[model samples]
Target: MSRRQLPSEIRKIEVLNRKTGKKVTRYELRMDAGVNQNTGQRQQVKRRYATDREARKALGEIAGGSTDGTFVGRSALTVERACAEFLAGSHSIEPTTRAAYEHALQPLRDRHGDMPVQALSKSDLDRLVNDLVVGTSPGHRRKWVANSINPMLNLISRVLADLVAQGKLTRDGAALVKRLKRSDKELQTFSEADVRKLLKHVENNRLGHAWHLAFSGMRRGEISGLLWSDVDLEDGTVTIRHNRVSVGGQVHNKDPKTETSARTLPLTPALKSALRRAENTQKVERMKLGPDYGPGEHVVVDEAGRPYHPDTLSDFWRELCVAAKVKRIRLH
Candidate 1:
């Protein structure tokens, strides 16, 4: 019978020079770190010491720790590697959140892709903050810092926290980064008159369904994902359970952002009338197209029964605002 392989443990130690291998000034120790739970593959950890005696001592400590189940093995994992691992195993993360994390980490990957995670210092983080703040006007920089940099920092902090929980990191590098002071400018909204004007302007337009945003307080994704089945004409209520988000020009159906987001909204008079009209219009179009019409359940759809892309509503609203000579407000 074949001999069973031994469990992972310290495997080798060597004395070596920093410049040339002959003039031994330091020692390198290698240990078998056993199989990775995430990847189901063997892993190894390495450490360096100034002298062979110190290396031996450190190895003995590691062995004792391993024996007592107190060992937290050192990892040479880089930021890129950690991010990759986190994203790969994070199957429960929503698609939109995954996309946001990917976007936030792009700049960091470009700057410190190959740098070891343990080697990252506060100074390196300071440089990242400085780079973002530099080469922009004060007002624009403040807005950009608030909208972009803060979110990136927050994402990095979360990633670092996860690393600490995994025992791969001892500290969160982004914990010290302070959030930038955001401008006190409040979110702008359309007045009652503006809403009336917008509703009248789009009354005959195909995008009349957009009136739900103003009357029902539904988000853009919720509006896009709204289906006829979820609406009760008799009860005048619309149920929000799903959201359609556009990422990379593709539309995806996902759960609402929060538990509160999935709710039943009572339709106001304006919303009820608008939805009724939309239903009638879709029915007429369906009859005209006959078999050519695509079968879809969404309340907001094109002439051929294709659902609108999530971004399409925003673009349509922008054009309608321009044509109607109304102050533009973003579709929520």
Candidate 2:
């Protein structure tokens, strides 16, 4: 076709091949990349592709990104570097959340860490979803359910979004990828009879007050991090101020999960009485052990007066279920 009849954004060009010293035909995609902020004039960019199809796809990305003010000139930014920078700059997230994101992004990093962010396409993301669904990705031994796979996709989406915002990516193809459909499962909870049995079994136990706190809807982490100063036995009130969560086999003491989670809660009559007994028992143990007993402000403690680890408390509850002959349910 004549130059006048050719598409405005794409055109064929001839270049000298370095090795053969012969002219080769290549398709060029040229577009208005938007005005440079440093200068008051418009900026444009050009890219050459071996095939018309490749040039057209890149043209689409540039057109969309330019229209939305998301386009920046191409560079050698790779998926691995983008992920690493995003994770490193994220300081506001909880440690547990950061750990979860790291795990979710592993597959993507392994599969496409070296791929240029500018060249990543929708088909690549789709193939990743397929591989994850069928458990065909490297290091994955079993198929992943939708619930398990969604978070990984979510992390990918977030990374892509950050890249676009930073002008490293022309557009976010990850947003076009569909999340897997999750199948719902019934939530299991303790029945009234199960609760009654558990309460009776632990009523006289050493950690009875701690069990009462769990039964009152306190999260396991909250109970593990509870301090005596945060509890008022006389006023029958408990303030939730801390949460000790396990991340990578280690526990971290942090603030409550949210602002609302740090509020005060009224203590039930049963809970109040349990707390009184626990306090008195601690006093007796302190006298018996003398200087050998460890001292702390924690409400829940072992015979040695050390605060319970969150994971250890979960294990303790599971064993308690079997001893109490009650149906097993996770103590959250």
Candidate 3:
């Protein structure tokens, strides 16, 4: 028998079988891996496999990765490490967003943290989503709706995307797993008459200014995070600079959600009047409570100046709607 020429980037080789003290044939893969940034030198890869099929499979992966400039070679990178790296390297995202990603990825970590990033398949993601939907995943005591579960899938997709960009993954496996079908629910809103009724009821309430802001289209977090300094009674303007949101039961105070979200708006006549009344009322409360008043400068607070969590504001608004005899729509 004579040796034959192997295909490009593949070579026939022989190595001693240490156990049997015999020589056995092996297929070897050799290819350029791209340049090393640190040393500015081209890199190459070489590996031997017991079979030709295995060698071809390994060659295709490396060649495809090199062609697309997304190959980082095989690694021990795990889902847990990738998620942590994504969160750590995410400097531009909001804290709430990062927290949400962490919350969403926790289940993936718990279930498949040890699995390599490249080893994760569409089936694994599908199963993970199924587990969450049925409340079988860790920490999910109740069944989750598609609307809630979809965001988790999106977060996973984002992590996978980051991995792909870093050459740790060839593609985002999460994207292949279709998002659970979300049920269509009619959006809830208040009619003019309902708005008027709530407005009339809140006119005499201590948190009237806060309700006015909500009616003016300010988000609950924007209202809760609004500082007294952000309100300009003389200029008749209010600035949206801060936003307070709760994630995992902890409240976080950060900048507005985006650049456009942090704009200054002219206050309407009714809103201005309500704000003045609120200021005076707060002053009176401060005088009564003296040192007991909350030291925070938040615009929306209780009589003792304690700032309300965004969720607390929503819960209280629902109560107010019931008392106002208006259709109790969410105060979002």
The number of the candidate with the highest lDDT is: 2
TM-score rank, highest first?
2, 1, 3
The predicted structure with the larger lDDT, 1 or 3, is 3
Whole-model lDDT for model 3 versus the true structure? 0.85
TM-score of 3: 0.71
- Could you say which candidate leads in TM-score? 2
Residue 177 CA displacement from its true place in model 2, Å: 1.6
lDDT by residue (tens digit), candidate 2, 195-290 = 899999998899889899998889999999999999998888999999999999899989988888988999999999999999999888878888
Off by over 4 Å in 1: 1-75, 134-143
lDDT of 3 by residue, 1-332 (tens): 97555669998889999999999999999999786433456768889999888888888887776676656656688888888888888899776777777877778899999999889999998887888888888777678788777888888898898777665677888888887777888898888998899899987888899999988889888998999999898989999999899876789988888789999999999999999998899899999999988975989988899998788888999899889888877765
Model 2 RMSD to the real structure?
A: 4.3
Candidate 1, residue 1: lDDT: 100
- What is the overall TM-score of model 1 with all chains considered together? 0.74
Better candidate number, 1 or 2, judged by TM-score: 2
- The CA lDDT of each predicted structure is 0.77, 0.86, 0.85
lDDT of 3 at 164: 72
